[model samples]
Structure formats: structure tokens, C-alpha cells
Target: MKKTYLLLTALIVFSYTAIAQAVPAAAKMNQFIDQLMQKMTLDEKIGQLNLLTPGGGIPTGAVVSTDVEAKIKNGQVGGLFGVIGAEKVLQAQRLAVEKSRLHIPLIFGSDVIHGHKTTFPIPLGLACSWDTILIKQTARAAAEEATADGLSWAFSPMVDICRDPRWGRIAEGAGEDPFLGSAIAAAMVRGYQSNNLRQDNTVMACVKHFALYGAAEGGRDYNTVDMSRIRMYNDYLPPYKAAIDAGAGSVMSSFNVIDDIPATGNRWLLTDLLRNQWNFNGFVVSDYTSVNEMEAHGLGNLQQVSALALKAGLDMDMVGEGFLTTLKKSLQEGKITMRDINNACRRVLEAKYKLGLFENPYRNVSTERAATTILSPDKLALSRKAAAKACVLLKNDKTILPLQHTGTIALVGPLADSRRNMLGTWSVSGDWHHAVTLKEGMENVAGQQVKIVYAKGANISDDSLFNKKVNVFGPEIEMGPATSDVMIQEAVAAALQADVVVAALGEAADMSGESSSRADIGLPESPQRLLTALVHTG
Candidate 1:
């Protein structure tokens, strides 16, 4: 017993020694950033706070930054998203380090939400599994693929806790349990960033839509979110705090109004709650044009709102150009202090330093690595395994699910043969061509012994306006030439011939992400009509 006690004391001492050893490394990093900041001019420092996206990937907002190349060369840009491919990233980094005056490196970022190239199930779907280890692995795989493509930052781990099914963005987050949501949030952060941001394969994780974004009024996108502080701390704020505690490298301010002030410009929320109360050391960035959108929220004009956001602890402005265009003038007018600008600039530069961009700007850029690493066999296999686990089995009447191998099966739905919606939403980098459809998967598993018939039971929706909205990124909902009645009859005909019928129906990929909120959370008219017909035929 004495010997055992001595050994336990030794272990505790060793742990303290290891922690003490890490303090010098932290001090050294601070010194380096301090030296770098001393050399930066006001304009150059403000440049570090602007994050832009070149026009290639999907733009979540109305404006994509113009003259991106010229801005990078002129030391007017800090980081960029939507710049895909290792080759392009190398070129962009070269422009920043070689052509710019300060020779500062640019950080590359992307919305690598679920999976990068090897697409996994959406976050909400993955949450159904309640397997935190599998969720972490998915995030790690996403980071590996993203970094191989020259991205150092991933704007993901959308940990907003939502109870409203009508909100389209609910699909982007874990469901409405704070304890489970907090666990998933920490797992994601650990997966993406791991224990080291300097590692080439790990990308920095950004916990997004901070505070109470998911509790938007009426389940609408970017709507007002007003909740009591008690409710916020008890029900809604746990996941965001959990992600921060897990060492998420950054946070994105939501577009909602919390307590009658825009989150981007709310000093109480961003400064007091995030930094003071919670001790979150990472920087804060605004959601897409959220700083500028505060003008529309009746806060102020572009300049006023930009100054307000800067003073409120928002370190970076994403795609708004509010910081780039108006910050210098705001500084001149004494509307915002140089210390505010300097503090924000230091945070942004500190993130770049942590990413090791200053030491090696091209650390993550390699065409060969990207080719070998993305969508590899192991990743695809993991994706398949995750998909299987994510599927929830609520009921199996008469043991219908374990379908006989030699029976005739009728698979009828718009989604059965649709590969476009397979990966779900926010998979900006996923290739739908590689996605296996439901019919193909069933055939592969059932083999030649089973006979299967498929039909596009109906269009996802008969509403033209809704379809148009869902198809913003691409053709998610394709309207076929056949009428609704004709399609329903065709599905009924297929069901009549088969011994068992399987109907695959749900929201299209875009129907539950970003701007795709629904007023009525029910099946669309077309799919509902088809399901009724199938029931009648039985």
C-alpha cells in the first residue's frame, strides 16, 4: 500500500511537470506574435481581419468578393475560402507571401461540414446514432481530406441546438439535447483540430452560429432570437460553451438578434459572455455578411455597424468588406480605437501563427497528397459504415425489414434513383457522381437472386417556387415531363406487381439546409399523393 501510494504521487508529479513544460512554448508563441504585430502597419493589420472567397464554390450570400487576386497582392486580404484544389491554394499563398509588402501568409478555409470528399451522413442524421467516437472519426476524416486539398481552416461543427423541425438549418446541427449536443461538439473539435494545430493533416475547427441562432423565431433563417438568460444558459448555450471548452480555434457570430441587439455588435454576448465569463481565447468571426447585415437590422450604416462589430469583439469580418473598406476611416474618426483594431488583428494573426502558416505557408498544399488522400477506399468504407449506423429503426411490422432474398421488391420514390440528394446539404466539396443511389445499393446487396423494380414515384414537390428555391446550388429537384397523376399511377402499378413495397421519401438535400425552411413540416403534395395511392393499391 505504501509503494502504490508513492507510484500514484509520482504520476501526479509527472503530469504537473508536463503542464509546466508547456508554458514556455505558449510564452514563445506570444513573443513571436508580438514581434510580428509590431512590424505591421495599420492597413496591413486591418487586412488580416478580412476573409474572402473566390468565385468557384457556392456562395451562401448575395455578394462574392470581386478582385480577389488584386486584393491578395495588395495586402488587402487575410484569408480565403472557396479556393479549392492544392494547386490554386499554392498560387494564392504565393501571391500573399511573395507579392505582398509584409510577406504574410494567407490561411485557406472551407465549409467542410460533414465529410470532405468521402461524404458522410449529415450531422443531424449522424446524431441519431449517438456514437460520439464515430462522429469524431468522421470529423478527423474530413480534416484529413480538407488539409490535403490545402485548407487549414474548416468552418464547421455547427453545434447550434434546435428544437424546431421547420428550420431548414436544423439538418446542419445535432438535435435538441444539450448533453448529447455538447458531447458531439467536443468530439468534433477534437477530431478536426486534434491536439495540435501545427499538424499538416489537422485543420482548425470553427464552432459556428454562436449564442442562440437555432432558436430563431418562427423557425425561419436569420430571424430574431429572443430568449431569457436563464433559458439560454440552461437549454441553448451549452453546446457553444462545450465547443469553446474543447479548444475550437474560432467562433462565428450568428445573424440573429439576441436580446434586441445583433450578435455581431452585441458587446454583452461576444465580449462579456464569450471571452470574460467563458474564457474562450480563440477569435470570433461574423457569419456571412452578418456584420453588414446589422445595417438592415437598423443598428447603423456600414461604417457604424462595422465599428460596432469590431468593438464588440468580432475579430474577423467574412465577405462583407465592412472591415476592409470602413475600418481605417472609423479609426480616423475616433469612432473606434486603434487598440480595438490592434486586438482584433492580433487574434487573426495569432490563428495563422498557430496554423504554422508563417513558418510554412504551403504546408497543406500538395496535388499528389490530395489525389491519394481524398475519397480513398478507407474513407468510403467508413462512410458506408457511418450511414448504416445512422439509420434509426423505429419499428419493423411482421419483420418486413429483413426482406426475403428471393422476393420481388418494389422501390418507388424520387429519392430511390436520385444521386444528387444522397450526400445531403452543405457538402460543397462532395461529388454526387460518385454517390451510389438507393437502387444501386440494394442491387449490390440483394444480388441476382432478388428481382427489384424502381420508379420515380413523384417529383419532390409540385410547388414551382419551392423547387426553384431548393435548386439554388444545383438541380436538386428535377421536374420530369410526366404529370403527378401519371407518376402516382406508375408507382401504384409497380407496387401491385411486387410482393413487398419500399417507399423512399424525404426532403430533398436542400429542403432542410440553410435557406430551405418549410412553413408546414409535412410531406410535399406530390409525395403525399403518391403514398396515399400506394396505400389504396395495397
Candidate 2:
């Protein structure tokens, strides 16, 4: 194992060496950046500080930027998120590269959290396997598919440490152990970046939710996090540091505040600690509209918060356009210096340079490759194997676990045959139609000898309000017209006819991701009702 780890490290180093040989060295890169900055206007520099989303993935606000193409042409848009497809990405890239004055290539980024096309087990579940190599391989596959789809960056490797199950975003992180979480964080960074940011198969890894986001009081999403600096250093900060140490190219500021100030505008967290103390050289991006949301936190209005965030070492503003629209006025008013804007723009451009975007703006983006790479047979098979290994067996007495493949089995629950929920949360690019249902898997393995019965035991939740919340981003929990009692009866009938009953009951896919927190982190009432009926039927 030690030898394998050493070889992995050596290979990553070689990848980096190969990139250096192809691109300019540090001194030369600096000189090139200096020359580029001299040619850029004030508006163009501030544009590089702005990051926008084009209404494809999760939307945090009502508007989805109708003028994105015009903004790109005017050199007012820096980069884009939530946009996929080689043709669509190529269209957007052309506006920046061909129509804009500087013709600076835009960096396309997305939340390729798990598998981009081939969905793997969730990060929390992947950590349960305790296989760092498997976790790294999953990340590598995600990066490949993302780059094939014309993305140069991934906002992934969420390393927040969370012990509270009530925290919805807990599904995205590697559980509560700082030691294990740090290890996973490093492995994910190494996998995503893979020692070559310029490589087509690799994408710049953004280690996210920086500075105690998981420590939100009461386990509420976007809630305040108050902790002593000692507690922060010892517990919550290690994973972020580990990711940075593993050469992550970007860091995302958490939405929650730290020590009475929001992380986006907190110099102590972003600059004094991350940059000065820990020596993280990567640029920092705000969570979606988090910089603008500071107004509600009583920090200031749009202009005040934008200047505060820029001065606090925030390099990229995601979705808010606070930096794009307000930074120029703030500069004229002397609230921020040209040096600060130049520094932020320089970092953003430097990331693009490292990504080889400056050399070949359309590096590795081919329609044919995009069509063949995503959801390939090999990737799908790996995902199935990963799913089997990640699931922990609670008990298996007398080795009765691996039942003979020739028996009648009943698979019961809302989740048993649901394709949409299979990919889990944050799998934005995963196609649910291709997911293998439990019933299909059972039938395939049984080889027509065993009869597999399936039933929708219950809806994800009986409460209408909860269903609305979970389905905000997508159809996470779909409710049918049948009554709960009818569904329970159907499930019990199936269970009675089978030799063994498998109840697949849990929260819906959206119930555990961002902005989907629950006060009671248990099976919903409908599932509990279904389980009780099944127990009585037996």
C-alpha cells in the first residue's frame, strides 16, 4: 500500500512536470500576466472578478441573467457555471474569445460533485468504504466526463466536517471525523487536479465551504457558525488546509459567518488565516450569491459588501454580479484600490493560464469525445461496484447474507425502483434514465430463475409542504394519487408472497443536499407506516 501511494505521488509529480515543460515557468508566467494586465481596462479587470450562472443547474434567485451573451461580448462577464454541453459551451466561449475586446477565454465551471455522467455513491457513502483509492478513482472519472463536456473547472470536493445528520449538506461531505475527512479531501484534490490543470482529462478542483460551514448552529442551512479560533483550527479547518496542501486550484467561502462576521468579508478567515498563516495560494470564490446576501446579514448593501469582500481577499463572486456592476464605482470612490482589482483579476487569469485556456481556448473540447466518454459501459460498471462496496452490512448471522440467487424476493419502497433518486444530490450531470433499478438488478442476477416483485411502499413524505421543499431543484420526491393506506397494503401484499423482503426506505435524494435541511432526521411518516404494515403482514 505504501509503495502504491508512493507511485501515485510520483505519477502526479510527473504530470505536473510535463505541464511545466509545456507551459511557461513561474517567472515567465508572471511576466506574461503583467503584460496582459497592462492591456486590460478597469471594466475588463472587474469583469474577470465576476462569475455568473446560466440557469441550468441549481438556481438561488429568480433571475437567470438574460443578458449573459451581451455581457460576455462587452467583456463584463468573467466565467460561467451551471452550463453544460460542448455546443452550448462553445457558443458561450465564442462570445468571450471572439466578440470581447481582450478576447480572454471564459472558464466554464459546474458542480461535478460525484460522477459527471456515471453516478457513483454519494461522498458520505463513499467515505464509508474507507478506500481512498476508490474515492480518488471516482473523482478522476468525474473530471474526465466534465472536461469532455467542455468544462475546465469543477466546484467539488466539499470537505466540510459535519456530525449533525439534520444538516442537509452533510450528504455532500465525508462525515464528521477530521482525520478521515482530511484524508478524503487530499485524495479528492489529487484526483480532480491529477497533477495537471492544463490536461484535458483534468479539471481545476475547488475545495469548498471554507471556514466552518458545517458547524452551523442548530444544523440549519446557511445559518451562523460561531466558534473560538482554537476550535476552528483544531477541528473544522484541517480539511480545507489538507485540500490546499494537495494543490487545489480554488477555494469557496462558506455562506455562514465565523466569529460574528461572514466568511466572504472576513479578512481573518480569508486572508489572515488562509493566505498568511496557512499559505493557500489559490483564489477564493463565494458560494452562490453569498456576497450579495451579506446585506440581509446586516453587513451592508450591495456596494459596501462587494468592496468588503474584495478587500478581504475574495477573488471571484458567483452569480451575484456584485463585483461586475459595483466594483468600478467603488474603485472610483476610493473604497478599493486598482491594485486590489488587478490582484483579483490576475489570480483569475492565472488560473485560466494554468488550465491551458490561454494557449488553446478550446482545449480537449470535442463533440465526438463528449458523446463517447460520458456514461460509458466501464464507468457504469465501476459505479455499480462502488455502490455495492459502499453499503455497510449491519449484521449477517450464520453467513445467511448471500442468499441463493434462485428465490422469490420482494423489493419494497419509494426508492427501490426510482431512477431519479438513484444519482443522489449534486449529481447535476447524471442522467437518471440510465440508472439500474433494484428490481432490474435483482432480475438480472437471478437469471429468470428467481421471481422479483417490486412495490412502491410509500411516498417519500406524506406532508405536502415537505414535498414542495425537496422538489425545489428537481423531482426529488414525487407523490402519487394513491392513499398511504393503499400503498402500505400493496407493499404488505407483495411482502407476504416473497421468501425474503427487502425494504429500501430512506430520505429522498433532495432531502439531504443543499437547502434541504430537516428537523427530524428520520424516516418520514409514510415510510414508517409502510414498514409497520410490512412487519404486521409477516
Candidate 3:
């Protein structure tokens, strides 16, 4: 037994050393970045900061962009976010490495929020279950599906400790406790990266909305945030720091302004704290267009804000070519140093190297493997299990749930049949048609003894403004014209005859995330009205 254990230890040490040889020395990696930068023009370098999403994997806002190929070939784009599927990712990736002049490989990213192909429960609900292992497993499965879809990074494990339920984006985080949030943050990092990111089926994890997007004043996303450093360290910084400690390779800055400065321009937070204090060796990327939004935060023009961000240690600017457009000019003007540009570029290149992209650019974009692995039954089974576990039994009055598969069940609401919303927020590349809605779950799980009666009780969301904002990603929530009176009459009639009534309720697709804040987060009027009607009838 002792000889066997000694032999295993030797084998493991040899394996780690072999893997270590693949990485260029820190100094050599910097030299490689330097040589590459010397050969590249400013526009080409700047193009790397622009992350665009073309609709395919998971939807972001109301719509996905249509011209991804042109942008990649023209060198106008740096990376892609909403695209997935191995073949699609492969096609997009080939455009960057082969078609473009720089031949730089594009990093494919996605929300991969819960289970990638297997729709896990939303993050907030998952956190409520207080199971860290389950959460990590969720991230592991997400990495597997995402890599299978040819993505290299995930914008996930949004770790901001939000105490206010009024904050709709809170549904995307660990919720209300920094201690718990920090622990979950570390677990997710471990899950996404595993012990070796260079290996197959692992994707880089981006600890996001860095600092405190969740602390949006009045619970509004992108609203200003002000808190003392002591408070930040004691309460909020832990999760971001925990993610860093756990080896998350990248961090995305939030849209919210911290103190008096927009996060994108906060030199103290990004430089002194993130790099110096935490000693985080990875790159920092901005949230969607956050660099441009600095203008809204009262910061100056694009050039000035972009310079400030680079000096402050921001490495990548997502969807905003602020750095690419202004950095060289700033370098000439002495506002920023070549060292700063070198550092940022080095960070980005190191990320690519750590992902093993140089060795095999198509490592994750395997078409044959994707066919065999993308939506396998095992993955689907995991999704169904995760969905079942994430369902919070908020109110199971009289033990009304664990609902025996026995009687007529009224499965109602826009989400009941929602093919798209099932993936939920940030699951940009996830396939909605693949998700099993409550209606489908009923058909699959409800036994032969049960009869299912369904209705489109109401739309997912009824607010015009909310619809406009959310519809930017895909389908706007359209209200049901089955009038409140008629829907109520129908619902009441069905409930009266049925053995049980199952009412599903929640936010419309667009009620959370960037620019999706809602001051009144109560159930939308349609469902609220429908619930009221059902109660009055009873």
C-alpha cells in the first residue's frame, strides 16, 4: 500500500510538471506579447477589446446582432458572446484566426448561468438551497456544455451580496450574505476552471459585475453605489476576491458608479485594490459597453475615460472600443504608458495561453464531439434534476405540493410554454426549445392518474416599457387579450372543476440585468390580476 501510494504521488508530480512546461515563463510570455504588439497597429489591438454578440446561444437584451461574420473578418470585433453550438463557434472562430490579418483567436463567451444545455435553476433560487456542492456541480456541468459549444469563457457566478429583494437582478446572485456569497463564489470558480483549465471541457470563469453592481442605490441596476472601503472589504469585496483566490482567470467590471467614479474609471478599485492588494494576475474586462457609459457617469469623452481605465488596470473593454481607439493616442500624449498597454495585452494573451488556444485553436470547437455530447440524455437528465431541485417551495399551503400526480392541474402563465425564457437571463447561447417548461414537466412527471388542464392565464409581463427593454433580446412579452374577465371566468371555471390549481408567476424576461431595473418588482399586473381573480372566484 505504501509503495502504491508513493508511485501515485510520483505520477501526479510528473503530470503537473509536464503541464507546467506548456506555459511560457512569465517573462517570456511578456516578451511574446511585446513582439506581437510591435508588429500590430493600434486599430488591430483595439479591435480585441470589442466583444459583440450575434444571436444564437442565449439571448441578451431584446435582440441579437446579425452581422458577426463581417465584424470578425473586418477586424472590427475582438470576441463574441451570444454565439454557441460547436459548428457555429467553429465557423466564427475560423473567421478571426484565418480571415483577419492579426490572426488572433477570438474568445467565445456566454452567460452559462446555471447548467449550460441543462437548464439549472436560476442562481438566486439555487443559493437559497444552501448547497455549495450542488452549486459547483452546476458550474461544472455548465463548463462542459459551454466548451462543447466551443465557448472559452463564462460571465457567471455574479457574486454581489444583494440584500434587497426589490433589486430584480438580485435573482442572479447568491443573495444577502457576504460570508455565504464568498464561499459560493470560490466554489463556482473551482467548478468552472476545475484544477486545470488547459484540459478539455473547461472554460475560463469571469467573476462579474465587479465591485458592486448589485448594490445599485434603491435596488436599481446601474444606479450609483457609495460605500466605504471598510464596508466594501467587510461586506462586498470578499466574493470578487474569493473568486480571484479560487483562480478565476478574468473579471468584468460592473456598470454602477462606485463612490463618485464610474467603475470603469475607478483607478483606486481597479489598480490599488484589485492588482496591488489582491495581487490578481488575471485580466479585467468591462461589462457590456460600460466604458462608454462612463459619459453618463459624468466622466469626460471616450478617449479620457479609456485612458483612465487602462491606467487603472482594466485589460479589456467589452463592446466598447474605448481602449483600442484611444490608447495609442494616449500613449503618444503621455497620458498612459506603453507599459500599461503591454500589461493589458499580456494579460489577454496569457488568458489565451492558459486556455491552451495556441496549441490547438480548435480544442473546444470539435464538431464530431459536439454531435455526440452537446445535448446528450445525461445532460438533459441533469437539467431536469437541477430544475426540480431549484424549485423553491415558497408556499405549499396544506402540503399542497409534492403534488400527487393525481388530479387535473391548471398549468397557466406565459412562461408555462415559454421556449425562450426557460434559459432565463444571461443564458445567451442556450437553446430555449430544449428547455422543459412547467407544461412539459407536467406531461413527463405527472402520472397517468393525473389530468392536466392548462391556460395562458396572462402574459409574462404587461408593462410597455419593460417589454420594450426586454424585447431587445428576442420576443417581447405580449399580454394575453383573453381579457381579465374572460381569463378569470375561464380560470375559475377550470379550478372549480379541477382537483388542484397550479399557478406559476415571476418576472418577464427583461425585468433584470443591465438597463432592466424595475422600481416595482411585484408580480406583473397580468398575473397579479389573474391571481386576484382566482382568489375572488374561490
Count backbone clashes in candidate 3.
Answer: 17
lDDT by residue (tens digit), candidate 1, 357-435: 9989999999999989999999999999999999999999888878889979999999999999999999989999999
Model 1: pairs clashing at backbone N, Cα or C within 3 Å: none
Best by lDDT: 1
Q: Number of clashes in every candidate structure?
A: 0, 0, 17
Ranking by TM-score: 1, 2, 3
Q: Supply the TM-score for candidate 3.
A: 0.88
lDDT of 3 by residue, 1-538 (tens): 9999999999999999977874546666667667877887666666666677775434434345456688788776767887777888888889988998878888888877776766777787788767888789888888887898898999887898886667877878888898889988999999999998888889999998888878878887667788887888888888999999999999988878777887878888888888899998888998877787787766789998898888777888876667756887888999988778777776887788778876678889877777777677877776667666776766767887678867787776667777677777655556677766778877988889998888777776656776877778677476655666676667677777777777777765556755566777778777888788767655
Q: Which stretches of candidate 2 lie over 4 Å from their true place?
A: 1-24, 57-63
Q: Considering every candidate listed, which one attains the maximal TM-score?
A: 1
Model 1 poorest ten-residue lDDT run: 54-63
lDDT of 2 by residue, 365-482 (tens): 7899988898888888789888988999999867867867877888899988887788888778888888877777777778767888889989989888878988887787888999
Candidates in order have lDDT scores of: 0.92, 0.88, 0.78
TM-score for each of the candidates: 0.98, 0.94, 0.88
